[model samples]
Every structure is written in structure tokens, then in C-alpha cells.
Target: MTARKRLFFMQLAGLILAFLVLEWLAGVFTARASLPYALSLLAYILPTLPLFGIIPLSLNYTNNNPDLPLSAHRMAPVRRYMVRMGVSMFFYVIILMASIVALDRFELSVQIKALLAVLTALPIGGIIWAVSRLIADPDVDEFERMIMTRSVMASAALTFFFAAIWGFLENFAEAPDFPLYLVVVVYFGLFGLVQPFVRRGFR
Candidate 1:
């Protein structure tokens, strides 16, 4: 195998090994064991560190460089991403507030509550799509696109794989049933982690 392909599979194997270790730890320890819980949480966060590098200018956005001009502060691309983030945040806050009010103020059925959450999630999806469109390369070559597609597929597979694994453990193994939202947070982070690996060794 090519170096890139080897690296990719190595990373994948490492992830699976870590999961297996965590599973064993969970199985060995009681539900209240904080050490296993903390280690499991660390495993999730560690894999996603590269995501901090892949997002739109998250790194240097906070750094202060003497050589950089003040004009960098007003760059259009930077402003655009910031605006995208702000708009999405505002809309999401509105949706969350409405959900809270509904749940706290009314005796809503499970179906209605789920429907409301789904409805709110649709706008968030649109916001993500719009932001991606704004920042994506307009003239990406075909090979690069294929690489990106692979990255996306890998990410989705990992997400579903772990989610199902965790779900099974929760139901049959007497492990914890973490909230759906928290699980999605980890999935999203994993999805973003795929971007840096795109187009690597595909040549």
C-alpha cells in the first residue's frame, strides 16, 4: 500500500483499538467509575484535535503577529466566516429558547417534542450548507473532489460505527446511554477531522 493509504488505515486501526480498550474499561469498572469515564471522554476529544486546524482560520485568528497588518483584521473572507457563524448561532439560540419554553410551559407529547427538535435542526443544516458553499473552492479539480468524497464517506462510516457500538453497549451491556445531542457533537467533530486527510496520497 501507498504511504498515505497506510497512514489512513493505521489511524483507523488506532481508533478501533482505542474503542475496544475503552469498551473493556467500561465493562470492567462499575458505572460510577470516574477514571474510565474520563479516559473514554479523552479518547473522543483527542482524535478531533486536528479539527481545530481544519476550520476557517481558527488557529491564527487568535494569535497576535507583529508583521501582520491591521487590514488582515478586516479581510472579507474572515468577515464572511464570522458572519456565517454569528447568523447560525443566533438562529440556533432562538430555536433552543423556543424548545425550552415549549417543554417547560406545555405538556407536550414525545412525538411533538421530537418534531420540534427536528424542525429546529433543519435550519441548522441549511446554515451549514450555506457556509460551506461560501467557503468551498469554486474550481476544485476532479481528483480533489474524489478525495474529499472519500473523506466524507470515511467520516460518516466512523460516526455510525461508533454510534451503533455505543448504542448496543448501552442497551445490552448495561453501559450508560449518553444523550443523543452529546453523541452528535462527537460525530460532528469526527466529520471535521476528515478534511485534513483529504487528497493525501491520492495522487
Candidate 2:
């Protein structure tokens, strides 16, 4: 594999590992003492940043899309990847701050806070959709887009799966805590984290 592809794989693997480590650490720290409001927000925001890098790379653009100047053309691939990711980070942070404010300046209940973080994807995903289209190869971008779309749909379908199973166990068998937080884990946690590796295999 070329350097870019190798780096892509490394970044992706690192992202998955980071999510597992961070989620575990968050649990341990929250158990001992709750994370500060800002830190808590950061925890939810940080894990998804790696994916900003993945979106442009995953498009697998064989040639530069926008086409930089002749001097910059040689490094066009790296430059394009950086530009795409930079734009994504900008939007991600925007959504993060917006949701933080939307959650009543962090005054909301824990469940609502979690819900805001999970739902931020709705807008952020739109940014991803737009960015991916711009960066994708016209011929093959559709396939990549299809893969991404299916992954999202599958994750969403699993949400219903969890609802049915968890609801039955909770209502019929008397489970505690209601297990609603599992929604985030099932949708974004497992499928969200797992889909990149699956996408990587496509290249």
C-alpha cells in the first residue's frame, strides 16, 4: 500500500482504540467523580474528530478534485486531505458549541446532554455528506457514498433492534435504569466505530 493508504489505516485503527480507551476512562472517572462540564463536553466531542480525517481519505480520490496550482499539485493529495478535514473540524466544533448551548448551558439532565451529543450527528452528517460529494471521484464516489449510507441505515436499524429487546426486558422482566443510554452505544458506539474499518477494507 502507498503511504497515504497506510496512514489512513493507522489513523482509523488509532481512532477505534482511542474510543475504547476514552469510554472506559470516562466511566471510571465519572464513577469516582463526575467530569467537569467542559471536560464532559470534550469527552463526547473528541472521539468523533478522527472521523473527520477519514471522510476525505475514504473517498479514495484518484486525482485532485478541486485541482491546486502547479506548484502545489504534487502534494495535492495531502493538501486536499488536510483541507477537507479542516473544514470538517470547523463544522464539528460549531455543532459541539451549538449543542452545548442548546442543552441549556449544561443545565440539562444527563440524559438530555447525551441526547444532544448523539443528535449533533444530524447536522454534522450533512456536512459530511456535502464534503464527501465534493471530494469523491465522480465514477466511484457513488459506491463509497453507498457504503456510508448503508452503514448509517444499518446502525439506525439496530437502534430499533435494541429498543425491542431492551423494552421487552425492561417492561416484561423488570430491568432497571431503563437502559436508554444504550441507544448511543448501539448506534454510534458499535456501528459508528466499526464502520470505518469496514470502509477501509473497501480500498
Candidate 3:
């Protein structure tokens, strides 16, 4: 196999492994311990991660390769994959919201939570698609790639720094109320902020 193909296969395998690990962890901790539910959720959710791979693959295949036309049959899988992901995310959201409601209610049934979770995931599907589109643009140029790489590295560094700080604060401070998610959101915003610098650096 070509290097590209090998990379794709490795990525695919890594995603599958990650999905399995998530499912196993969820099963062990959460009341939603059903294997089928875990597997289904993973199938629907994990595709979002590798949507990045699709952009590069599509660009590589289509650019300067008139003879190798975009195969509809091959592309069909990606569409189906996205659809599954959307459905899964939508239901997952519903489940979370419903669980919140269920906790308030008199009964606490696993089945009820599971059903509500699936129902909640519908709207989340739209958000997932939006996120996928935002990140995976087919027209990504060399400059964009550099920006994205640098942004990701910066984000990673920021995350590590924040994690260490949070750990220290927990140990030293009386009430450490660090908003980790907000820090992550800021890091995500930094991607856009650093884009100009990245472009200038390349120039």
C-alpha cells in the first residue's frame, strides 16, 4: 500500500481503538452499561474526529488527477458515516438532558435515561455537522495547514499549562474554581487569533 493509504488505515485503526476505550470507560462508570448502546453511540460519535482526514484525502485525490474521478461509491461511505455521527450526537444530547430531568422525577430507571439520551442527540447532530464543516474545508491551502498545525500545538500547550495550574491550585488554594472548559474555548478561539501570525511567519 502507498504511504497515504497506510496513514489512513492507521488513523482508522486508532479511531476504532479510541472508540472502544471510551465505550469501555462509559460502561464501567455510567448507569448506561449496555454494550450495544455504547457501541452504537461510539459508531455515531467517533466519525467526527476523522472528518479532518477526509479533507486531506479528498484534496489529494481530486487535485491534478483528472483520470481518477471522484468515485460516488467510495464517497457514499463518508456521507453515511456523517449521517450516523449526526444521529448519534443528537441522541447523546437528548440522553444527557433527559437524565437531568429524570433525576428530578421520582423514578430513576436506566432504560428511561437511555431512551431520553437518544432523543436528546437529535439537535446535537446539527451542532456536530457545524463543527465538522468549520474544521474540515476542502480548500485548505499550505498556509491554512500551517496555521492549523500551529494553532493545535498552541492549544495543546495551553491545555497542559492550565492542567498543571489547576492541579497546583487544588492542592494550595482553599476554593479552586477554575473553569477548564472556558480555558479550552479560549484555546479554540486562539486558532483564529493566531492565523494571521502563522500566515505572516510563512511569508
- Residue clash pairs of candidate 3: 90-121, 90-122, 91-118, 91-121, 94-120, 94-121, 95-117
List the pairs of residues colliding in candidate 1: none
Residue runs of model 2 more than 4 Å from their true location after superposition: 1-7, 13-89, 95-153, 174-185, 188-203
- Please list the residue runs of candidate 3 whose C-alpha ends up more than 4 Å from where it truly belongs after superposition: 1-92, 106-139, 177-187, 200-203
lDDT of all predictions, in order shown? 0.57, 0.61, 0.55
How many residue-pair clashes does candidate 1 contain?
A: 0
Better model by lDDT: candidate 2 vs candidate 3: 2
lDDT of 1 by residue, 1-203 (tens): 55645554566566557655654554455335534434544433343333223233332432333333335443444456556655665566456546654575579899999998887676677556644554463443345456656766777789888889988999899997778766556755776788767645653
Question: How many residue pairs collide in each prediction?
Answer: 0, 0, 7
Expressed as tens digits, the lDDT of each residue in 1-203 for candidate 3 is 66666765676667657656864554454444433444544433444444344444544544424544446654444454455555555555445534553464447578866666555555555544544453464544434445667766766677678678777888788556776535645665665576667668776
Best by TM-score: 1
Residue 24, model 2: Cα distance from true site in angstroms: 12
lDDT of 2 at 125: 62
